[model samples]
Target: MTNYNAVFAATFAAGAGVMGMAQTADAQHAGHNNGMSDFDVYASSEYGFCDAKKIASVWGQSIWEGKMTLANKVRAGLTDLADADIASAEGVRCDWSEAELTYADATQLASYWGNSIEEAKSKVADLMSGMGHKRFVETFADAMADQTEGDEYDVGGNFETYVASSYGYCDAKKIASVWGQSILDGKLTIASKVSAGLTDLADADIASATSVSCDWSEAELSYDDAQRLADFWGNSVEEAKSKVATRMSEIGHKRFVEAFDYVLR
Candidate 1:
């Protein structure tokens, strides 16, 4: 009634203008610091103003030296630096981003690699380019857990070759956990649990069964029993074995003696 359409258009135009100015300011600020743009610094996530400022400062000091691809990696929590590092970098009045591996993950990774974080990060960058962050972390963690003595064993090379020749990280980790690091490192030529007709299960299932020393291959349960065990107790084949064994033992001397005899045999 009161030229509402015109009013809406004006309001929209004014909002757009304000947004344009803000973006311009951000771009200018980014240019003054480095070749980074406002989009580069803040477009990755929904970070607040202070967080954006902190990320910008950190990127300028630490991550700017690396490839632009590394910005997403930093955002993904792969960098050793954290919020604290951002604060420290800001306080130092430094021109370069002094991003280093200062976080707990860095420490764990460094210890696993038996090298400093800087050295580990170089390898990690390579792994990240191909395997991605999650796969890289899982593969490295598997390798580390299996490693007994080594400063480093050309893990990047090993991972590349392994993935190319065989399956991906999850399968590789499962094999490595069962067969040992020697299999992955090429000390041992070939091993196959799967080839032997072993039941292929999730890593959690295998881990749980193995923890309780359950032989999944030989253990047999009805579908209902397995489902109940899985859903109620969160039991793997191995975990269910003890419970089943106890129940069988108790029931064998009672009405289910024939069934127990068959099971025992």
Candidate 2:
């Protein structure tokens, strides 16, 4: 199978298999479910968004108390808690198989396991020792589906975010320039392009950014997009996109630091 098909297969298994497991678990644990397996209960709990909220609240308190920095909390707090929960749930008989994870939880699981779902499942097998591995992988697949359900292959939403975050402002500027050129040549509006989800357009945007040198001065942006970014980043409206891109290029990754960054909170 192609890489994309492999990914699709992994996600499909998680979505379809999770429901089947949930139904089977419910019937099996009908009356005496309370004292059932920890693994099963943990799986079921992931679907309960309220539980995630409670966990977030506790993490907030920890931040307030200076127990951890906001960055640290953002990075590891929830994942750590989830891992702890998984560790505790191991070797215990489960009540239900309805385990569904949040996007963030699934992302962490993927990071821990592997590049692809199959590879990740193998890592889970290492941890699970053949127990609950299939269920965990299925639940993770469910999360993957949730994350990409509507946004798949969309050029504007996740693609834009990915470019900005992964390649920084320099690359973002290049992409915007190339996209603007495409608009001029194809007589396409930004809205139309975004809604179109043309793979060639998306591929071109990525290719232009990755293949070129960073040059904020040469980057193009529509007047509206430039103004919006300018207002958000405290740059003057005159040459707004370039100005914003210049600042981002200069700041680079250090913008995350509390002191060295030029942009205000």
Candidate 3:
């Protein structure tokens, strides 16, 4: 049999048909178990699992980061530099968990093409289909980038405030310089400042500095930034230069420039 039933499965999926037994409407098929239940299988429904669950599974880990994970579901639509970072972290893949299984055709292949050509093609066509052998990679992204651009997250209530207070007064643009999404909590100001100079550094050098010198900080403009502003405010040009020179040597010239900009801003 050509499994014309898979055609039936397709029509059935358009609305409310499911394959194999599952707990929810069609989560098991999607590969994202919302709840911690074996019964909470991937929804196999053509509709729900294909989009929602699949979206959740692959993106679940990637889209999730910083304080957003601490917020309520459907609350934080998506977050800042974390959003872009999640995308950059993504490796090239055939499809998400919700996508149709491939075959020589085996639909479920954790690794490269399996045993036989037929085995390689053994995929779940009803879930997705094509003329014959082909790889289905629709987008090269992992999040709703255009829809949820910038660091101004969509979380409701105190979520934003909580993230800001715990993290700092900075935003996504500040984070992208050194991938500052993981930098929530106490060192917020410092972390954001450390990544400051990296705007002009090469990607590799920036990454290196970020990894090694990540602990630098001005601490809410009260330390280096405040002191510099004060120096330039009521001192002779020589005095100011001397002060700036000292700070630069202490924190490096690039970092000093970054801190000065942030302080003045």
TM-score of each model, paired residue for residue: 0.19, 0.19, 0.17
Ranked candidates (TM-score, high to low): 1, 2, 3
Which digits, one per residue and each the tens of the lDDT, describe model 3 over residues 30-131? 323343221221111112212322233334421111112212222333323223332342332222212322111132232243444333333422223221
User: Number of clashes in model 2?
Assistant: 3
Better of 2 and 3 by lDDT: 2
lDDT of model 2, residue 31: 27
- Show model 1 residue runs off by greater than 4 Å: 1-156, 182-265
Residue 60, model 1: lDDT of 53
Best by TM-score: 1
> What is the TM-score (0 to 1) of candidate 2?
0.19
lDDT of 1 by residue, 1-265 (tens): 0111122223322332122222232323332224433234333222222232344455652121222223444445645444343344334221101111112334466777799966665565544333332234446655434332332233322232332222222233233345433223221111132233332332332243232221211122232343455555577744664565454333211122233333332
| C-alpha RMSD between model 3 and the true structure | 21.2
Mark the 10 consecutive residues where model 1 has the least summed lDDT: 93-102
Order the candidates by lDDT, highest first. 2, 1, 3
Tens digit per residue, CA lDDT, model 2, 98-118: 121222333456665557644
